[model samples]
Target: MACTQVLLLICLWLSVSDAFTYLRVHNKSEVTVQDHWFTQRLDHFNGADNRVWEQRYFMNDSFAQSDGPVFLMIGGEGAANPGWMTQGTWITYAEKMGALCLLLEHRFYGKSHPTKDMCVANLRYLSSQQALADLAHFQTVMTEKLGLGNRKWVVFGGSYPGCLAAWYRIKYPHLAHAAVASSAPVKAVLNFSEYMDVVQASLSRNHSDCPRMVKLASDTLIELLDYKENYIKITKDLYLCEFLVIRSEMDISFLLDTIAEYIADVVQYNNDNREFEGVKGGNITIQVVCDIMSNESIGSPYDRYTNVIQTIMKSKGEKCIEASYQQFVKDMRDISWESSASAGGRQWMYQTCTEFGYFQSSDSISQPFSGFPLSYHVQQCSDIYGEDFNFPVVTAAIQQTNENYGGLNVQSSRIIFPNGLIDPWHILGINASLSSDLVALPMQDAAHCADMYPARPEEPPVLSSVRRRILELLTEWLQL
Candidate 1:
């Protein structure tokens, strides 16, 4: 505690800090490599226009073993900050295992903003290929920059980014020593039918407690789809107001998505007597299937049709409120309810239906309830018409068939793909082509992002086991 001793300690700390300054990347787009490390603007590759990149590095820091295997921690989606992967007990444990962690933000989603306009006009720029390229470039730069030319690095991600982790290793076998893909959907792409079908089944299985509400919403949606007027009328009634305009181009597919998602969440939560919180929990339900569905900006199927009607009237300067069910039936069309029987098609059923082991499409009419991702665009369509629509943007992107995504034939080093048995997205695993390179872990009673359970106390033992394995694998990988 003496001033003289404290001053000496401060001097020692400053010297150590200087020694620890391994590398730094500059805005001038250059790669500066030194004896123990290197830094560079990852976007400057091949002198080609940089696709909005980030810096990556490995260090033999004060705590890390200089001669040990170097580990790269790749977080999922919008993890622009190094502190992003703060959750998951296993993730924390992995970092403590002496690995030099590296995090990269997926383009357009976080700090790695897309160079192009992110509006609907330029949404196509944020495809998976661009992300894959960013990862590959980061790997090459980090390896070469810090004199880690011969060091081993690992890849790790959860949810959407987890898909990137799997595809990354398959695309560039030489870049990573191993990969840990948590709850990753590597084959779903344009086929969400399997996922939707699962959600529907989940809703149906819980019908005992909220049977009347569930049936009413589902029936209302089906009936509204019979005709455009009826659909608009129903939407207006549900919305309790009138707006001007309508889109004949708008398929009943949107309605179907609302109905299915509403019944699944609300009905199931009611059956379990578990409380469902709104935006506070970062969730909003679209419908009230027994008050179970989260608050969706668009309301439920019954309310959805009503909102449409209200909008149409409002736009036309008419104050029409009530829409007769009989009048609705008179305007019905003869379009057969789209089926998910087809394997690979552009139908909603094909796009959202469970592939159950094949990359088929779901041409069903229903949509997802979550608004942040696809659900956000689907609901917005009821009020506005723009390129921001999720359906249209994805409709174009999916048509491209990202062949390079799953093109490699090499075996993956170490990877784990977990899914929920009852979770809708789990169906993508069915279509997943599992080989020695991939390991599929499915939880029997969980839902999307369920791996965050067990560690969160709301999950089961199997979930905990998966978390434990991830830590074990990460520790082993880092020490290797």
Candidate 2:
């Protein structure tokens, strides 16, 4: 069957959603919202399966004409925030194109979860293939509801969902006229150390000494933690509420994760990019971190990292810093630590372990400070999902995904693959066009989903060009 025409997904906006405080609840508290729900089959491919689920959806028909385009926006790894429905680059373009915009929550995410319990058995239905099926069913029912069965559709998403946009067109072309996949990692990878390599590159671009200082501090910290005597010193320097002996490899991995996460944020969000309007307080850049590290007036490298965490925490206006909070270390030891991360990251963790395997592990190819081994990530899967779902399943899933979807060798057409050159995830994304119809629009100096952010007045020249190209292609697709 032809893939139903979905809206042109601009960007996954993972980083944008991460840092930006676009208040979905408070901003549109009294906007007279028109949220709706539909009954979706739990297993779309099964004829005998009778399980049904109520899926959440939001739509705006004011811009629709009798025979207008259908814009289907998809969410990823988190709840479908109402701000996306109310405003964003996608909605802005929908208005310009006279399209009926619809935002569909991904199954197993947000309020659309099919199962009552988040058990391992329940997450079996959580896959990109299933989510794509939801899009098709929703498009059919929605087109009928709006009396626009004849209208063309385009699919749009960012990051994971962005990969879905490209896959939607490839997997079922008849339903969608075209797709816009921004920052989509179409090729599933196992050892994702390149993500940190890009993090190093991002810091290098900001200032050479930043990454060097980072490596210096990281190696020194790991060495000191090896000795039992330095545990107190490590705790005091990093501002931890308690001292922890390195009982397991996971212990230091957690500490490494905390520090790497902060660096990843700066690079991925370009939090220091003064020209980027979406990221507030351009003070969070790598240069600022380096300045903190280099100052003789400041304390040691451990103290520098503490300041970095404090700066980020202060900007968030939160009283308790996760790095300093006692529970932060406690959760690392918990079985459901993955779930405790913001926006219920457990679902995404399951997806990554089972299908994507984008575990940001450190190898010889990565920075010297990057000591997060492949075993640690594998251990995390065992820690969270138990023993049955082992490394073989993940290996098979990665191989199967590539074989089925064409992976990096996608032969599909009429899809715009926009990736920021600086996005570490781009290592697995479609960086070059496969054909004339399948275009690769690269944001030379942007970060992950940088193009997906709300339109800024001082946009980078490449981003502006890519936006124009996307609008043009979407316009042409609607006409076809």
Candidate 2 residue runs with Cα over 4 Å from true position: 1-32, 272-283, 318-342
Candidate lDDT scores, in order, read 0.44, 0.72
Candidate 2 residue lDDT tens string, 1-480: 122222122232123223222223333223334546667878888889866777777766556566678888887788776566656677667767877777888887777767654667666888999999989887776666546767888888889989999999988788888898989998887878888888888777766777777777788778887899987777665555466656667777877776677667776766323232333545566567667767656677656766776776566454442443235433432323134542556778888888888888777465635657877787777676778657888888888888888788988788998888877888889888888889998888787776666667654568877878889988876776
Off by over 4 Å in 1: 1-83, 119-125, 143-151, 188-191, 205-215, 222-279, 282-402, 407-410, 430-437, 452-454, 475-480
Candidate that would win on lDDT:
2
Worst 10 residues of 1 by lDDT: 1-10
Residues 159-231 of candidate 1 have per-residue lDDT tens digits of: 5666677777777777776776655665535444455455556554544333334445556656555666674
What local lDDT does model 1 show for residue 444? 61
- TM-score to true structure, per model: 0.58, 0.86
